[model samples]
Target: MVTVNLGMLHYVIDHVYGAFMHRTKISPPFFSRGWGGSKLELLERLINQLFPDVEGQIWPPNLIQPMWKTVWESKNACLREGVFRTPCDEQLLNALPPESHYARVAFLTPKFVSPQNMACVVHLAGTGDHTFERRLRLGGPLLKENIATMVLESPFYGQRRPVLQRGAKLLCVSDLLLLGRATIEEARSLLHWLDSEAGFGKMGVCGLSMGQYILLLLLHF
Candidate 1:
């Protein structure tokens, strides 16, 4: 098991940190939420943005499942928000509404202030039983700040609950790991999509707990 300490370090320095320094490559002039008092009207502005809202609704074989009802998703041309991990089959992508642009925008939304021409910040949630509405509620302040219009997303624990039957059964470590991998896999999909479909800009991800882990994976990718 990955220790919490090193794992968090891997998340911050590699992923959350330096979102702007890298965005400098594209000479991006915009900024997301500023870290402190740094102010810029265009700090968190969305340009050529796309929001792809998908659903991760797992109807397990068992009629009675423990996992949450659904996992919400949000991806945009500029910023995507959700936990989209499992590999996408042709059917899945095709099912999604067609996109007008080939590449979408992305953002980090760090508490920093710059202009609007910089890269983007992407925010994903960690373990929680949050519904789409609830997630949006939590994201209200940031969104209203118009801090780089986040693509609010969902993770396994976010809205999709695990098999309460099995998870509650208190299974072995392997079983728990199996469950965890599926959740992480869902998170992986989001990063993969950003890397492949989003423009070739400096991308950064931020979250706590599971969010942190997913951010780490994004950096490694």
Candidate 2:
């Protein structure tokens, strides 16, 4: 006969409970909101796309034409607000709606005074973001220091978010990835544009929350 001592009894109890028990059920766990089979398949595809072969040197994106559009002009600091746009990868574009205002960076820079060395910051925004609505206080000291600050309209942000979508809500999984791809590319495009622009003495990128997160990914690609 199998001998079950106190320690063995405890082990058996743990095994049985572990299979069908939660230590705490106060809040739903990660991925607890089960995505259906179709979404799961998309999740799989997303995984594959994200996890590319970990071999070979990372290649830079090809030259893309940047379309600049002025949205706001700040008299406080001679801020000339403009949008920086670059054509996204054709494949990525296919995923987005035709009218989708994707891959654009809203910027603020000094107009009258041209700095011999343009020190720029690629500032980013958080949720519920509107034009110049980011938490970061763009004007004042930085402008005084002659540091030009620009903000990239993140995926599903400002003009980039589809008009039909209405409000900023959690986008579908595919849309999320689509946003991510566009975002990384947009950051790359911005950097490329800065590099091409003449009189680019020094450039810096800064952000909060989502912005901060992308910087990590930006350097990797």
Look at candidate 2 and give me any clashing residue pairs.
Answer: none
For residues 53-165, what per-residue lDDT tens digits would candidate 1 score against the true structure?
Answer: 22333322112111122233334112233322234334333322232001122233323333243343455555542433433444445633434423334322323333432
Q: Candidate 1: minimum summed lDDT over ten consecutive residues — where?
A: 43-52
Query: Candidate 2: TM-score?
Result: 0.68
TM-score of each: 0.34, 0.68
Model 2 per-residue lDDT tens digits across residues 1-221 = 87769998999999877655466553334333344226577678765664355363254555455556555567645444454443565666766655454455555566666646557777765555645644336544677677777677766666666665545553455665566666767666666666665355677776666667766766667
How many clashing residue pairs appear in each of the predictions shown?
Answer: 46, 0
Q: Best-fitting candidate, measured by lDDT?
A: 2
Model 1 TM? 0.34
